[model samples]
Target: MSHYYDEHDLSRFGDMGRNAPDLWDKFNDWYQATFQEGSLTGREKALIALGVAHALQCPYCIDAWSQECLEKGSNLDQMTEAVHIAAAIRGGAALVHGVQMRKRNAQLSM
Candidate 1:
């Protein structure tokens, strides 16, 4: 079966700069700087990225960040916890939005 997400396509991500070299360069610079060691260690940043990848539901980012987390010395346990944290935040956000729906329904009922 053919899948829409080709793993090989991830390798070509750098090619995104071909048509917009300046923009891509700026983004790349910012992205690289963001991941550098600062208040957080590289491993911590990788774990955070992994959590964000799950929250965003991006297969490419998930795959990349999983490897990055592992390479940066995060074990499966830590990565799993990060994923769970992302899931909890995403689930909570969805549930919190239901308050808006409830308010609208009450307004219509009145």
Candidate 2:
């Protein structure tokens, strides 16, 4: 099926650099540094990326990080838990926004 987001297009993510090289170079440098093995192991970082990918609902990132997680040595269980953590944080953020609704309702009632 032809979807709006083509899987092949993921490979072209850097194509924007053709138009603006400086911004692209800065972004690429940041990305490379961010993924380096630092305080967190590469596997741990991949799992975190997988979780954020799900939270952001980016198909390309999900696909890429799923493979990266495996290649970095994180197992299914670890990745699954990472996704759950993202879900919990996302759900909590949504729930917290309800406080605004509650405050507005109280003002209207008064």
Which residue pairs come into collision in candidate 1? none
lDDT of 2 by residue, 9-102 (tens): 8999989899999999999999999999999998889999999999999999999999999998888999999999999999999999999999
Number of clashes found in candidate 2: 0
TM-score of each: 0.93, 0.92
- Clash counts per candidate, in order, are 0, 0
Model 2 ranges with Cα > 4 A deviation: none
Q: Pick the candidate with the highest lDDT.
A: 1
Any idea what lDDT model 2 has?
Answer: 0.95
Candidate 1 wrong stretches, greater than 4 Å: none
What are the lDDT scores of the predictions, listed in order? 0.96, 0.95
Question: What is the per-residue lDDT of model 1 for residues 1-110, given as tens digits with 9 covering 90 to 100?
Answer: 48889888999999999999999999999999999999999999999999999999999999999999989899999999999999999999999999999999999996
